[model samples]
Target: PGMGEAQAVPYLMGHVPEGVTAGTHYLQAISTGAVFMGAVTYIGNAPNFMVKAIAEEGGVPMPSFFGYMLRFSIPFLVVNFIILSLIFF
Candidate 1:
């Protein structure tokens, strides 16, 4: 009941999307989708910024936010995320 949607098992309790059912299968799919989409941009994921900070401190020049998306995420992650969404969500 309390924070059930946080685990994706809202089930007539927590906040759910407009048409999505509150269930284990949807929960898993949504969680997986969140992970995949979060990789699409630095700001989308907190760990990305942490890693960038660590790498820069170590003398590795990380791309800027948009640059990372243009050079890496869009080319690498977006397509895969799209495919995953199509298949799962």
Candidate 2:
């Protein structure tokens, strides 16, 4: 599911039933609880509104769902392979 645009975009474009083009399609993947817990604490999950309130208190502007992941979580995901290699091998 973690695929780069170069690979996934073309495959998805090619598989589009018959008449669709790459320009007409969009794809995105999201991780809900897993990613949410990574950046913020577990408290972030229990009290959703409280998280927002605290962020505002700290002057941290909350990003949109996808925006938050792209800015923060994607970097972690990109380097996760290296982390795995270090741990396992």
Top candidate when judged by TM-score against the true structure: 1
Q: What residue pairs clash in candidate 1, if any at all?
A: none
User: For residues 1-89, what per-residue lDDT tens digits would candidate 2 score against the true structure?
Assistant: 68887899898867778865544322211343345345443234556557867897899988766765677556775467446445644
lDDT of 1 by residue, 4-86 (tens): 55565655444555776548787888898788787788888788889999999999988998898899988889888878778
Where in model 2 is the C-alpha error above 4 Å?
Answer: 1-44, 47-49, 57-59
Candidate maximizing lDDT: 1
| Model 1: CA > 4 A from native | 1-22
How many residue pairs collide in each prediction?
0, 0
